[model samples]
Target chain A: MSGTFNDVIQIIYLAAASCFILGLHLMNNPATARRGNQVSIAGMIAAILATGAIVIHDGLITTTGWIVLLAGIGVGSGLGLYTARTVKMTAMPQLVSVFNAVGGGAAALVGIRDYSTLGSHVAAATSVTTLLDVIIGSVTFSGSVIAAGKLQGIITTAPVTFPGARIVNMLLAAVTLGFGGYMIASPSLAALGVVIAAALVFGVSMVMPIGGADMPVVISLLNAFTGTAVAMAGFVIHNTGLIIAGALVGASGGILTKLMADAMNRSIGNIMIGGFGSGDTAAAIAGPAGAGVQSIAADDAAIQLAYAAKVIIVPGYGLAAAQAQHEVAALADLLEARGVDVSYAIHPVAGRMPGHMNVLLAEANVPYPLLKEMDEVNPEFARTDVALVIGANDVTNPAARRPGTAISGMPILDVDQAKSIIVIKRSMGHGYAGIDNELYANPKTSMFFADAKKGLAELTASVKTLVG
Target chain B: MTLLTDFIIFVLSLWVGFEVISKVPATLHTPLMSAANSIHGIVLAGAILIAASANSLIGYILAFLAAAFAAMNVVGGYVVTGRMLKMFKRRTVPASAQAPAVNAGQNGGKSA
Candidate 1:
């Protein structure tokens, strides 16, 4: 490559990096998130262009290679677009898991291809790194797939625990590690294959025992593993871009997984052991007796919200499942227009994952200022006229902190402290954790049993009419 | 050096770049991008390694610059992300759920 061109490519790469930083900055706020996304994309485009220019200058890839690359790109892009458009919000977590698996799988494949193509000519250090990449990558891929299946309900979300399951997995993981070590020593294709197989089995076993409630954390952890594995693969192949991208993903995913695990108040090891929230234990906590606690209709709920001098809207998994964010926002707008104070009370673990509720609300273009964290908003509930619990169960369930409760000692949103509580839910089914919510039965609480989307739309219309 | 190879590389780069970018959600863009900034470090590492092995001074100089830029990206990216996470923490409810001093309006009375 010409000196000037190389310099330009370097500059472009730097520009792309800057865009990435800007994008991340914008992502902190809901209103600016879209702009952030756009900026990052622009950066990525510049980086790709710069990298392509350099690779071409190296004279390594040929015309045929280029054609194949384009075809692969076309196929991958088509599939990605289709999936993004067709998949429902309810299935988003599963989709993300699947994507993570694909990334891991791709990284493993790259490692394998590099090792096989170079064979003994590759350095001993490179061989070891490659073997590690394949092993970790394969495990992350398979585990992520299982996690996705569980989240999608294609497989049961209950912990598929069998007697001696932990022992069996431990033995398998040991064998996999042994094979990985052998591959590092010998650099043989056969050893690598064995390591891959063992890793795959280990992944399946690792995810199979985790119940539905812990899938989000598992997925995040797996995503981190995938990133680390990809970075290893990048190291083996001497690809700077891949290494950077992979490491970034790995580190962030790890942090996210830790944060999510903390939100659930469970150790990562405990989550992997399975059966923690399974069967009767979960049932005892989230039963229907807890379901029938208290509820009210749309008209009455609207009246409460409309007439209230101060109102707090608490969103949960139900809101996401119902895709009722926009409607909820509309209702809030109506309430605000009517001179009724409206603020969102968001619990850390309210949705399926950490910040899940925030993401959904942000998508609806809700003002960032109105969204209050649990600590900030919980106190307001006491003086608040009404606390609207929308499609949330366990987080707002006062039973969490009440004595003798399964969830006792867990901190929860003090929705119970609100003068009146209006819970909007479809049915009396317990949350994933299977704990009965006492908020439903409180004298001040009333259940508005309807599909979250339908119910919120109705409420929005009612609020509009009332205000008019 | 060939035109066809260059064209192919360009197309492939664009495709990969666009695909990754498109998958990012608005909610994740900031974090993901910040996270991706770590890529610059990878570039720097690669440049340094190549530079060490290269016979030419130009290669060494270019490699050094790349590595330096990438390191900057890594340091800067983490600082921003840390700030963002801190912001998230700030919004959390108070540890104690006790009512504040001023009664904004209603007391903790039950509403039928």
Candidate 2:
């Protein structure tokens, strides 16, 4: 009867796993995405309950253990709900990083506790997996924390470097490996401590030199690390569910990281090496000192927008920073009423995080069909009467097509091809690529210096009076 | 208990993951990350196992923390992703707001 009971529990786990697979499949379409989340939540609930049954059946948990587990669940649930509900769309990337950190930290602790309990009696296979779990998990934990800090503006977004930074990283790696090797050979608790410590420190150093601009890729990379660590923890405990889920996340995160890097026209290998965007240093080198830029008033810009046959709005990080998604959507709605065609042109790396702009725009109830990707919208720019570039700089730069520039070979929106161009920005500032936007100086382009939110509102007001 | 079985399962899951996830549109990347983050919260099972069997004070403490972290990851990731998706399904701005930017009523129900 007991054997049958265990088999039944395993079958439940299999069912939960299937839910996960189906849930992910449903997330491919916008119309079905919400239901996909619901299905995934149901699977999670089932997984949690099934795991609880297994633990209870083992009869290993003492009264104190039960109390601790209940308290943990309560506190964790409370914290999770609070943050998920309270966090703004702007801080979504940092929140994701924080989740990644905790996931990684928890996986490492599981491996550590398991290793300490087994000591010399642990099998060679388990030992190897456990050690790897601890290393990757610990690294992911610290690295994710730093990444979150950068996104939250708690830490400087500039690439923090020092003399012999590469050498220091190498030395840390060697020491971590050496300690890991010692633990494998002897199975002592002290060696394990050293391994964990070295790995944690290495994590911080690795992410510190990666500038804020490169954080989206870094977050994705750390996400993959967290998944691999979880898989390692699964191996230690001999749990197939954990292994499958972890492997899935690891593989998906890896692919997303590569795709993001390709979108930026940079290699994953180069990004991992760090020191790409050094913040102000790169900005100073390509500063906009002598560019011939023409500034247009809100009403003047409104004249161009109100009468345009077709307007393509290109939104970037500045738009997100000013929380102008709703404003832009409102403007588009206003224009559409006048029979002027409007659609958003989204560059792959436009926002700080992957799909950052889409999430923000979605919040404003922008129609799903109106948000167009780079390739789909590039050809439409030439036919557009007015290309309204809002707070987007680098991705619109013509410099990307030329060799020897900071953003050489990067894909850009064809805003310059439009018959007339209107740019809304705060001032003549460089974008994250730390370079000037060549499109800003084009004869066809006129700059309107203002915050994205204010600029959109003003233009909306102006169009109302002028067009009516 | 051959390690090879787990290895094969791991390798196969990776392929399945790549195939399934690559089809997700760019619009859902945030939700995709959140969903994937919750899936890896399966590590909570390992934490529960260790906690149930832990005999020492330190072991119990470590396991408790691990369980807490994993639980947060699972719960927070799902809730946040759901909330974001709910916004995606919200009705596009009401067609009645034909005036200029003065109509804040449509967005009044939502918080900043």
Predicted model with the maximum lDDT: 2
Residue-level lDDT of model 1, residues A60-148, one tens digit each, is 54444444444444454455445545655456566556666666665666666556556566566677777777788789889988988
lDDT string, candidate 2, A1-468, tens digits: 168877887777777777888788777777777778788778777877888898888887888888777777678778888999999988999999998999999999989998888858766777889899999999999999999998888888898889898899999999989989888888899999999999999999999999877877898899899999998888888887888888988986887797788788999878878887665223323222455878889999998998999999999887988899999999999999999999999987777677888889888888766888888899999999999998788889999989999999988899999999999987776777777788888999898888899999999999999987
* Structural similarity to truth (TM-score) of each candidate: 0.75, 0.94
Give the whole-model CA lDDT for all candidates, comma-separated.
0.63, 0.84
Top TM-score prediction, candidate number: 2
In angstroms, the error of model 2 at A186 is: 0.7
Query: Judged by DockQ cut-offs, is candidate 1 incorrect, acceptable, medium or high?
Result: incorrect
Q: What is the DockQ of the complex in model 1? A: 0.05
lDDT of 1 at A64: 42
lDDT per residue for candidate 1 within B1-112, as digits (tens), equals: 2333333433443334333333333334334533443332233233323333333343333333333333333333444433332333212245632323533122221110
TM-score of model 1's chain A = 0.87
